[model samples]
Target: MEKQFSGQNQKKLGLSQFVQAIEASRTLAITTKVTELRRQGKTIIDLGAGEPDFPTPAPVCDAGIQAIRNGKTKYTHNAGILELREKIAAFVNKYGGQYQPEQILVSAGAKQSIFNALLAVCDPDDEVLVISPYWTSYPQQVKMARATPVFLQASERDHYKVTAEQLSKAITPKTKLLMFNSPSNPTGATYTKDELAAIADVVAQHDIYLLSDEIYMQLVYDGLEPVSMAMFPQIRSQLILVNGLSKSHAMTGWRVGYLAAELPIVKAAAKVQSHSTSNITSISQYAAVAAFELAETELQKMRTTFAERRDFVTQRLRSMPGVSLSLPQGAFYVYPNFSQYFGKKYQQKTLNAALDIADFLIDAAGVAVVPGEAFGSNENIRISYANSMENLAIAMDQIEVALKKLQ
Candidate 1:
């Protein structure tokens, strides 16, 4: 017999199939473990974090405080406040996006902007091309939108950059979008203009949208300038460029991000957001305005610091025996192939996957890194250099010493 509606006899409501299919974030799991260890009075050097270790620039903080003083705490327009949108338009224009205030949608973060764009464009049977060694959220978000994430796996030999040929071959009739990231997360593989142009030529031939995630464009090093898919006029109608202040301005807690696209796409994303998060915090929007107005000198200081750390981490990793990675040009993480040590054993547990490497590091060296499996690869683990040099040096030294102990 069917169960009657009673708290005692009622069957448990099951979780959504869609959500059940999504994998829990391994990075967040590692973060939780690190937090617990710290709570237990353990000293853990966490290189797993994706956010900047730098504090938010002072003027930006002042802007938020000023916003509060002005009582500007009401819900903003769904597309964002006009002033912030205008400033964002100017910034987007500099990156080759000919966007107007009406063409932008500011969401909770670049993440939400991407999610909104995915929901706006992807149908149930649609396929989204994701680059492997990807940001952890890409495939999960695609799946959450009921779209299949088809990976275009780039080889470490290619510096983890997807080629035009690979992209051309990956596109099918069901392909609805391509998620392109430059100065990529986890790998820090930034593509050059020539590579981008060749990729653009392929996308131009297809009836697909390009959701370009350039959140780390401002953090590039090695005399590298930022390039954008918006720079390609051929795909302008099909382009959705997402950027946020979280990474660039050390405003992760502030939750401000935006997308620049065609008017219809922006309108659709606004519709999606209106049902979910509406606008981001009004205070943060005002602060984001000041974020754009931040002095170049302030940004340069952080960039220079990150560049030094990147160099230090790169040199350290390359010097380790059996460790190798392409020199990362941007972003703050170094992903070194630790697959060479996969079969090595610790006390009793055998190292097998990237997750094992991450776990073993925490136990052996008190170092916490995000496993490469979190980013759709298991041959390596991601070590973010978004920490102070002193901490970074200590972490690297501990890591090297710990590696020698594995047999």
Candidate 2:
């Protein structure tokens, strides 16, 4: 039986309408569904989330617990603990950028740091240029800020890189920021220094800001050195580099990420964070300090393992009949081009979209992968190999069999 709402109650609930763009956006939906299915006893192999499958390193967790025991749970400085700000400044400086403690704004996660940057920099009706295959949140966050997100498609033929020539074409007077992610989430593409310098030259000449999300910088593979946009002298004035301990230290649940920028941008981000989700978690801030100060050896081990998995998964994807993947220098995803599978039939149902292929894999192959639509592509899908070797092997086997079944 359904409970009926009173007329007055109905009117109250309907007063605030949801904006359609915000309501329709989804990428976390698949991960939530997979978790729900597992809770109901279904054996699902999830490659849908961009999270690590490893536990947070022991030392970081211990520090958090110790902070609580030592009664350090009070509210912290709005910008973050001074020590953390200093540590972050030092870390950012090592990347060939100059940063003072005043230029660091700590937020709940790297996701929030990105939002803070958009909020601080973009205005209503302003244009923000984002390259294709972006993190799903960029457009949605821009919409929430009442800004327009302009997308430029980066083709796989060019290794999915956005050239300075292409960027010059995308810019207009209204373009306030140009956003790109190296070691991108879904495609795992890392831009070369020369490529970045070229793009930086374009943005620098235009008087626009460059938003570089380097959250996966530490996970780079096969001798690829990830370069920061701030390293370019011309771009440093307008660059906001977002990074966190999430992937590098396996500290996703800790919710510690910081934005490194000039003093004005950082101050604005801190002010916004103050009224929204202030200070992050006091205990987690302490843990983050340890994450930044710890030795590099353990982190290197994680990177080595991810590199092996990347190679393994890329080779497996290539073996599939119609699937093709480019080798990525960083991140643990293989975005396989599956346009050849479109217009075919699977169980008498026509496959038309990347979402369709993803659903087929999950429902028929028992493997969960993110659709390319989540990353602004309709001809591809992302496969994450952050699981155990045995599980990744089994999932790949099932995926190949499932693709062959499509007519």
Candidate 3:
């Protein structure tokens, strides 16, 4: 029954409890707040961006332009253009998975690809295992599909990597899927091949599926080899491999991402996508084929630059007194504990959580960062080094000074 408003005959519509209970993405939330702050004539150094600082590769950009000139603006297949799927299949196969174009489903972004996979495999009330300090989207997407999210916390002592023992212990009859991200967001921790294999073995014994999010597969540093969940053939049949060109190819705005999974899962996700978004933009699909074809050249250049910036950020953070963090293996973010300053005062207010520190940084230090509470922890904050080296150096310097003033 709809209730009438207090002095009117009109009745306001209500929202579903599930939707009402959902929290907005804290990463994007901070980005929005930073934009608002900068609009007020305040100098703000934004290190909270989630995408690469580099531009999309030249070949990929040319491909998109060509597609537009060739009048390829109309919609294509619901699953995406055949040529793009073939390239995605070949790309995933190159990374250790045996895939065919029939199993690939292209979507708007890696975000949608993951959500499609979740909606395809999950039933109402099913539980999804989300390792903590996870991407802010995981649990929200799980809930959007009516699945309960079961969070397993990874300790900083382990470099935030979960072990096979923990994976085995977390599974239950109610668990329908495991959302695994390596070169994970927020923490930037990547698992080794042997470590992934052990966890894959545990999943192999269960009836659940593993949705490996390898969005950051191309960003590892410090002489580490990239490992995909698809590398382990034992779990291949049950693996739902998710990856895209956004991070590796710097095509965040192009909106091209795909999942290589079993045919049934692909078909199911395609059906869900069909009613919702239909095919992704035609020009973007054309460019994605180019991105896959031009593999390592442009990406290597960006990766090298990011590696240098990572080194600088790591060294600066380590020298700060009372600060501690795992050496991030890949991706562009650093999750560092700032709990030592929790009881310190800024103005007349005490810093009680990561949110407070984030607030203090933006207001006092002119820097923007996402609080750890956004990633399921309150003792740390995530600083994305996806900015210019000069900006990063200044941000770090200001962060250090602002932190020292907590007393």
The digit string of per-residue lDDT tens for model 3 on 1-407 reads 77644532324555556667799988889889998998898899998889988888888899999999999999899999999999988878887989999899999999999999999999998999999989999999999999999999999999999999998999999999998999999999999888888999999999999999999998999888778898788898899999998998889999988888989999999999999999999999999988888857677888899999999998999999988999999999999999988899999889999999899999989999999998999999999998899999999999899888878
TM-score of each: 0.97, 0.95, 0.97
Query: Candidate 3 at 343: error in angstroms?
Result: 0.5
Per residue, candidate 2 scores C-alpha lDDT tens digits across 28-63 of 788888988888998889988788888998888999
lDDT of 1: 0.92
Which residue pairs of candidate 1 clash? none
- lDDT of predicted model 3: 0.91
Clashes of each: 0, 0, 0
Model 1: how far is 249 from its true place, Å?
0.6
**Candidate 2 weakest ten by summed lDDT:** 7-16
Candidate 1 residue spans exceeding 4 A from truth: 1-12
* Tens-place lDDT digits, model 1, residues 1-407: 88555433234655556667899887788889999999999999999999999999999999999999999999889889999999999998998889889999999999999999999999999999999989999999999999999999988999999989999999999999999999999899999989999988999999999999999989999999878888999999999999999998999999999999999898998999999989999999999999999988999999999999999999999999989899889989888999999899999889999989999999999999999999989999999999999999999899999999998
Model 1 steric clash total: 0
Better of 1 and 2 by lDDT: 1
